[model samples]
Every structure is written in C-alpha cells, then in structure tokens.
Target: MTAFVLIAHGSKNPKFQEIVLKVAKELENKEDVKRVYVGFLMGKPSIEDAIKKAAANDDILVIVPFFIAEGSHVVQDIRRKVEEVVGNRKKVVYAKALGDHPLIVETLYQRYLEAVRE
Candidate 1:
C-alpha cells in the first residue's frame, strides 16, 4: 500500500490543523492510496512522527510538504526528519510543495475571487 503524509508548517491557531486534516481526508478517498496522514512541523504528530506512522503500515510512503516554497523547513527540517525516521525500511518519495504545481496559480486566482466577492 502507498501512504501519503502531508507535512505543513503548523500554527498555534486551531484552523491550521483543521485545514490539514481536511486535506488529508480528501486524499484518503483516492484510488491506490491506502492511507493519508497529517504532520505539522511545529506541532503534534510532527513530521518525524507522521513518517514513522506511514512507514509502519505502508510499503511506500510519500511525504508531501504543503509549504509555498523550498525553504529551510523543507530543505532541512522535513528532509532530515524523514531521513532519520524511515532509514532504509519503506520506499520513501518526497513530493514538491504546492507552490511548484501549476494548479497553484488557479488556486490563487480562486482565492482572489473569493476575496473580491466578499
């Protein structure tokens, strides 16, 4: 089974975790995906913990950063934690941030429209 772990830069606000959970729920229903886990860089069930959980049940684990850019959080923190937890057990794949995707432009536009409509 292939499991996905979405890592986000956590916030003290409850809404941040809520958003990540909602995203994870959406991913869980997709075909070929066995499970989806949410991780926070600065909160509970951290990136390391999430990876370990995914590595436990799934043969392949995909760690996706929800960040906007490839900053230190992605380059250093996320990568380091994944490396430390998984080691050589499960096959691990690191996915790029949302900002790297072309759809992000459309998403931004939608957000703009929402603001303007309000």
Candidate 2:
C-alpha cells in the first residue's frame, strides 16, 4: 500500500486545519491509496514526524506539498527535512503542488460564470 502525506504550511486559524484534514480524508477514500496523512511544516506533525510515521507502514511513500509555485519551502526546506527522515527507509516519491492545472482554470471559469449569472 502507498501512503500519501500532504504537507501544508501551518496556520493558527482552525478552519485552515479543517480544510486540510478534509482534503486528506477525501484522498484516503480513493482506490490504490492505502492511507492519506497530513503534516504541517509549522504546526503539528512536523515534516520529520510525518515521514517517520509514513515510512513505518507503507513500502511506497509519496510526499505532496500543498503549495502552488516552486518556492524555497518546496525546493530547500522540505527536501532537507525529507532527506533527514526518509534516509533509505521507504520508496519515497515527491509530488508537485497543485499549480496551473486545467481543473483549476475550469473551476475559475465556473466561478466567473456563476458571478456573471448573479
């Protein structure tokens, strides 16, 4: 089974956490995905801990960042942290952020159409 860990920048607002957890739950329901976990760089389940937990269970681990653009957080910080924890544990795979996808454009278009209707 493959365990996917969605890493996000932490926020104090409760709603922020709620949304992240909600996304994780939705992903977990998908097939082939054994479990979907979440980790916050700044808040709970630091990157290190999350990787450790994921490494323990699944043979395939995929770490997905919840960022749009390729920034320092994705390029440097996350890489360093993952390297430290993963250390030849599980088969680690990194997924790019949700950026410039056709679905995002379609969603925006739908929103615009709704606003125009109103």
Taking all chains together, each candidate's TM-score versus the true structure is: 0.92, 0.87
| Model 2 RMSD vs true structure | 1.8
How do the residues 41-112 of candidate 1 rate in per-residue lDDT, one tens digit apiece? 899878878887888788888888989989999888998888888888778888988765779988899999
Q: lDDT per model, in order?
A: 0.86, 0.84
For candidate 1, the per-residue lDDT at 61 reads: 86
Model 2: lowest-lDDT 10 consecutive positions: 85-94
Clashes of 1: 0
Clashing pairs in 2: none
Worst 10 residues of 1 by lDDT: 93-102
Which pairs clash (backbone N, Cα, C closer than 3 Å) in model 1? none
